[model samples]
Target: MAKSPLFERGMVTRRAVLGDKHVDGATARKTDFDDDFQTLITEGAWGSVWSRPGLPRRERSLLTLALLAALGHEEEFAMHVRATANTGATAEDIKEALLHVAIYAGVPAANAAFRIAKQELAKLQEAAE
Candidate 1:
């Protein structure tokens, strides 16, 4: 199948935010069943939205984390937390975002997200060591 321009752009933006190793692993694991699903997100989420210049990646990262946490999407929230290192979002920034989640999205959601964030941040710290 011919890759659309949007898919190409999305691949670049996805790599920039998620890192090449992560993206490569996901690509290698792609199956015929999920190939289209993968393409949709690559084009829709990474290409059209993430590639836009309206908001910097740091801010986008924060928004994504908050939304994922509020919706109780634990896995995606953790992934985005890990992606923070590449997004230029500091631990402090994540704290503030989670605090908002606690107030607006409910304490339970925020609490769970906090735990995941802590674990993911620790992993990032250890990786840097």
Candidate 2:
């Protein structure tokens, strides 16, 4: 099937934010079982919301970190933490967002997110070295 324009836009946006390596790995891992689901997110999340110009990618990165943390999506939160490299969000920005999670979403959630963020950030720093 021909990919839609939205999906094409989403592919560009997703590659911009997540990098080619990660997206390539995801594409490689896709199977018939999850292919549709993958396409959905590529089009929906990356195309519709993330492609919007209303907010900069930096702010969107922070918001996504907060929501993922609050919802206890640890793996996804950590991935976004790493994605900060491409999104222009700093560790300080992530700290502030997690602090809000502590206040509004509860300390426990923020606490776990902090742990994951710290680990991921350290890995990023190490990779940069």
> Over the stretch 1-129, how does candidate 2's per-residue lDDT look in tens digits?
999999999999999999999999999999999999999999999999999999999999999999999999999998899899999999999999999999999999999999999999999999999
Estimate the overall C-alpha local distance difference test score of candidate 2: 0.96
The local distance difference test score of model 1 is: 0.98
lDDT of 1 by residue, 22-52 (tens): 8999999999999999999999999999999
Note the Cα lDDT for every prediction shown.
0.98, 0.96
Estimated TM-score per prediction? 0.98, 0.99
| Clash list (residue pairs), candidate 2 | none
Task: Output the TM-score of candidate 2.
Answer: 0.99
Worst 10 residues of 1 by lDDT: 16-25
RMSD in Å for all candidates: 0.6, 0.5
What candidate 1 gets wrong by more than 4 Å, as runs, is none
